[model samples]
Target chain A: MYRLKATFIKEFKLLSVDKTGITILFIMPVFLVFIMTLIQQQAYKSMSQSGVPVLLVNRDRDSLGTAVERGFSNFPVAQLTVDHGERYPNEDAIRKEITNGKYTVALYIPANATKILEQNVEEIMGRMFNKGQIANNTKVDIGIIIDPTANKPMVIAITSRLKQYLADVKTGVLFNIMGSKIAGMMHAEIKGGMPQEDIFSYKENYAFRDNRSSYQPDAVQHNIPAWAIFSIFFIVLPLGGGIINERSEGLFIRMRTLPGSYLSLLSGKLLAYFFIALIQFLLVILLGVYVLPLVGLPVLHIGSNIVPLVLLTVVLALAAVGYGLFIGTLFDTPQQSAVFGGISVLIMSALGGIWVPMNIMPEVMQKISSCSPLNWALRGYYELFIKGGGWPAIQTEVIKLSVFFIVCLAISYRIFQHKTNTN
Target chain B: MEGKACIKVRELSKQYKGSSYLAVNKLSFEIYEGEIFGLLGPNGAGKSTFLSMLSGLIKPTSGEAEIFDHKLTTDTELLKRIIGVVPQDIALYPTLSGRDNLLFIGRMYGLSEKELKDTVDKYLNRFGFEKNGSNAVKTYSGGMKRRINLIGGMLHNPKILLLDEPTVGMDVQARTSTMEFLNEVNEQTKMTIIYTSHDMEQANTFCDRVGIIDRGQILKLGTPDGLPASEGCKDLETLFLKLTGRKIRD
Candidate 1:
């Protein structure tokens, strides 16, 4: 116990003097969390939240054009711009606007669209009644010009939405023509031409498996946990480097002659590094909960209960410290451990969804992601923040992280023993 | 001063993995209690390998050795309490205070908190480090750093201390002071000291007896003053070069 305490004190003193190590352990993580969250928030706004801009040149000057113009105006999926009673721009101007990326889409409606639709419907009905050929003979093509530089997926989605809206507009115009013709033939009075109220509507909901209104994931929700897990795993840099420093400096030579197991010395150092890991974790969480909101990003929602999160953080710290001990024991030189530990953590972070979210990764990568210890830790955080889960939801991650800690520690001890024996 | 034999070795050998031959082969020697014994050798001469075997840092392939009835192989953990090793490198933590370094090492040797504090205080003054004990070791000079390194091993006060090139890199004054301090400690505690050095003259003057080894076997062993005359050399250095050869190992 004394040895452990001594080791802790020694590490604390050494770390206190190491400005670079302290910065990496504490300040860099907080800074990274803030920077990454802000960057991803902008990406989220551009990709998902903000509507695509669409410029409309409606030429019909009647109900069909007005309806089409109104359909896109202030739409959640698109922002529509249409000038009333203004000179219509030519195809060249519309193409130029789209080409310059002034708008993602430029739509044109032909002149007399309502009249053409009404004529087509009446002629088709009359032709059928007279036992003649029936067809949409009169042409009224709705033109769509798209920006070449626009994202293909976003353009495809917006275009698909535009097509559905146009089809509905055409159906409404045809229905109005048919209704008025029927009313005139029966000599009946029908107030209001083809009721403007929608016959059908769709409302999409964000739901849990139980269909509860689940919280939406923003950049803060995703990045905070990811960067937190990344920072925790980064403990290996200082921890492993410390061991290598001791060995290279000949401290290990003196230590080997001490009358106790190396674990006694290591436990204190592990606890010290674990303390640093906890601070790093808390800094990230605090930045997520407090600083991110101040920066105008969405507030990080850590669910209602923090008990499971706290438990998981402890276990995650252990896993990180264990991994650090293993790396430290395996390498003989500081430079070797630093390079390997730094690069390996980065790779783990990449695989663990720290750099990219798991849901966005390819199917094969998602499966491989589960193999990273950082992923296990991040999953626990996801349960707390995104899933709004308790202990049971994160039980698997907790178990996996715990087992990883044990395995790393066992390997570290065996390696340390082997080294001491070889010495 | 002569005393009863406290360290005994017979047919001790260590053949490291992948090595062609034994690093310490069929060695036999005994070190008496309270004697400053110097083990000398050039590079790759098995001095370190032999020291490692005696200190229980590494296992000997074939060996039977005893220190106060503690077997080298079987009672290694028990022997650790009785043995101390000071490496050639400056092992003290540079960022930590010299006092903190000693106290931590003392604690690792299972010294209680009060014992650690008291022993560290006493040793800092003994090594003339009290004035600079609170300062970080990195702030200390090379000699000061060397002093703290030496103090780290002595904090536990083991019965037998194995020093590998303890005074190799110090200036003349620092080296003289360090040797004088060790002599004072040896006279005061009657602790058996087994050290290695390239400084043949210092070893001749300080050590009661000396052994020059090469290729894992003892080439010569006798009292320091008696060794040179036995080899018809003017001094220990001349005799050492003659036995170990003039060719540079590096």
Candidate 2:
């Protein structure tokens, strides 16, 4: 026990005095967190400040004998001006506006829209020919021209909405005018039947209240916090590698021979590195909660679930250190141990949902991630913040992470013992 | 004669796994307290393997060793506490200051900070390492780095020091000063020092008793002057050549 204690103390001494080690442990995490937070804040702020812009121009005459514009006049969109009444504007003007890149969609409504609507045949044909540049050999040609330079998503959105409006009007007319005609046709078809049933009328007779509303739940919408949490969580690599360095340096050998057992020595190094990992965690969380908020990524949501998330991260840190110990024992060289240790952590994080959002991953990947410590880490945070889960909600994830911690430590102990035997 | 054997090896043998050759075969020897013992041999002679086993850096495959009547196999901790090891290969941290390396090693032996600091400072000054004490070891000259390495292992005042070629690759002045310093420590503190070296003259002058070993066997064990002179053999070198029947080259 004394030998192990000596080993632990010697490990601490080496860690404390090593300039390279101190910088890696203390400076790297904080620096990376600060840089990551700054970059995320900048991105989030830029996204929030911008909106899609669209323009519409119309020359069609309405039934009131006044020119009707293509879009609503009070529509809350920037650069939504109509073409000049007396001036003839070419397609270049519309292209120029789109080319300026501010407007996402620009619409051009042809003149004499009333002429085409005067006849139902022309109106029906206009649906297929508008924006298509097809020949219409009738009273007059009417069309809505769309700028080719506009974004495809914006164009799709505008066209879909316009089609919906037209479809709605056509449906209203069909239901009102064809209802009685359709009833007569149905009666003729069912002439031999005992009775004819009107499904719509029957549904109307059994009236019921509608109590549904659309509300999009966008909790944890800003990505800055997510980025901060993830970047901070990766500090496990360097911290674990630091312990491995001590082992490779023969500090463990020295300490193990110092009248103490290996357990005490292992415990001391574990506790020292654990405390350091905790400090790293706290620095990142404090920055995420207090400092990141100042840059428009305020604590969007840190519900009661945060406790489990933080605890789970700490557990993962322990697991990472255990992995370091395993690598240290398996490899004799510090460089080799660092390489294997880094790759293992990266694989875990990738599978655990650190690299990609879990919801978008395939079902198989999601299931696989659940077994990863990184996955538990992300879930612990997501539940507390995004899902607003309480302790009970995160208990399962916490338990899994704790199990990972225990398993890792067991593996580490076995490998170290084996190495000592061989030595 | 303190009546205490600093090191006692009996029927010690080591056969590495997967190899038929015995690195150290049935080696047995003893060194009294306050004496310098040299295990001399050529390359592949198993001198290092034997030294490592005695230093508790490794366990022997067969038989065992005793240092100061403490069974090495069972009481390794007690043995390690009194023994300092200066490995043949440089073990100092290349990136750490010389002083920091000494302090780090001193602390491992449970020395108080103030005492370690004073001891390190005194040793560094004596070894001409004080001025460059804060310089990284890798930046120092080979001889300077060797001095730091030696001081690092000895900072805790261990009763027995085990060195594997402590003066190899050093200049004549550096080698001479190092031997002189070892002689001073052996006389002043009565520290039992065992070193492995191929340099016949250095071993002849520095060691009280030299064991000329080859192929895992000790051919001769006696004081430098006690070596059997032969065929116009005038000194330790000629006697060693005639005894081992092999010239020191390589």
Candidate 3:
């Protein structure tokens, strides 16, 4: 343990003197989180207010087409721009407009839309009033054109809202057609002898409930943990580079003469780097909770599960330090280690959904992301910040990160032993 | 006059994995207590390799070596505690101050905090760098770094000291000061020193006995004046050239 302390002190002192390394380890993460959160916040607000640029082509001159136009116009989240003409534009022209960036999305309501909806309503009334015999001969197909160049999230959001609006319109038409028939039946029953008080007491209420405390999307909740995990993984550059430099400079050979095992030396480095990782994690959290709020960004909350949050951060640091040691031991020169470490961290972070949320990614990519250690840490953070989950929610991810730490440390120790023995 | 053998090598040999040539082959020698022995050779002649094996940095392929009766292979931890190794290259952290570097190494050697502090301060004062000891090693001159490197090894005050080209790249003044300090430490402390060097003049003047080595084997071993007389040469350099040949090794 004393040997480990010495090693830790030595590594800590060495790293502390390196101004650039210190800045990257602490300052860079805070800066990235602050800037990214502010930028994403602005984007969310703009996206909500500006609304998706939608071009509506109405071919039906009846109430259904007008209803469709009015539905988009009344929707608070979409900008409804109607093209008034006798004929609807061709599919090719709509596609061209989308490609030209004139609009992000386009909706075409066909001439038979009103007729089809009316027929559906009539069939529904026949089923309810007559003995369940009805004819439905019309199919309602609304063509939606989306700009391929637009971001995936924008395209998905607009398409979802359009589908929801159309469904609501269909439901309203069905209700309108069924109301009068049900009223006539009620009137006949009342004359025979029914209570008017019961009819007036009929009430149905609708509300929204979430699994978590609340369902609000805020940038700080996402960016703080994501960038913090990214910064932790980046410990590879300085830690790995330092290891390579020590080997090349003959410090390892000199160190071998000391009365301690190689494990002690490695343990010392692990202890030091882990402390650094923890500090980085806390700084990012502090920035989100206190500093960013002052700048008008939403405050980040760690929910009620402090245990899992702390456990996950420590395990993540260990995993990152182990990875740094492996890279340091594998490479022969500082430059080699630097390039490999830098590029590998960036690639892993990107794959792990640090740059974009995993929910927005394709299914195949989401599956592949599970292999990244960064993904494990990010998932645990999301459970704490977004899901407001306690220990039961984040236990699996914490165990996985711990396993990653052990595996990486084992491999690194073996390589270090081989190199020192051969040296 | 020689004392008891501090180090003994019995046909020690090392052939690196996947390499055809032996770096050190069937070499046998002994250095007595309180003696300064020098291993002289050209580059790649296995001088550093032999020193590394003695320092317990690498394992020999065959035979065995014992330092102070501790086997180099089996009793490595014990041997490490008794031997001080100053490598060929500057091994101290460039970012750490000289004092911190010394104290850190001393702790690794199992010295108590108070002991380490006193030892570091004593060495710094003796080396005439007491005032500048707080400065980082990267800011130090070549001579200052060399002094700190030497001090780092001796902090534990081991019985056997192994130095590999300790004064290779220093200026004349630095080299002279380093040699003077080494001689003083040898005479005052009676520590057994095994040094390797390509500098014939330094070895000739500084070493009590010198061995000429080439091609993984020792060609000649004796007092400096005695080895040259046997080769019919006036100096150690001429004797080395005569035995190792004139070809330059890469």
TM-score for each predicted model, relative to the true structure: 0.90, 0.76, 0.85
DockQ of each: 0.72, 0.23, 0.69
lDDT (C-alpha, whole model) for all candidates: 0.84, 0.65, 0.84
- lDDT ranking from best to worst? 3, 1, 2
lDDT of 1 at A131: 72
Task: Estimate candidate 2's alpha-carbon lDDT, on a 0 to 1 scale.
Answer: 0.65
* Prediction 3 TM-score vs. true: 0.85
**Chain B TM-score (model 3 vs. true structure):** 0.97
What shift in Å separates residue B130 of candidate 3 from its native position after superposition?
4.4
Q: Comparing candidate 2 with candidate 3, which one achieves the higher DockQ?
A: 3
Off by over 4 Å in 3: A55-70, A80-102, A106-145, A151-217, A360-362, A420-423, B128-131
Clashes of each: 0, 11, 0
Model 1 / residue A22 / CA error / Å:
1.2
Name model 1 segments beyond 4 Å from true: A42-51, A76-80, A83-92, A110-157, A184-187, A199-217, A330-336, A411-423
| Pairs of colliding residues, candidate 1 | none
Candidate 2: misplaced stretches above 4 Å? A1-49, A53-269, A300-310, A331-347, A413-423, B1-3, B228-232, B243-250
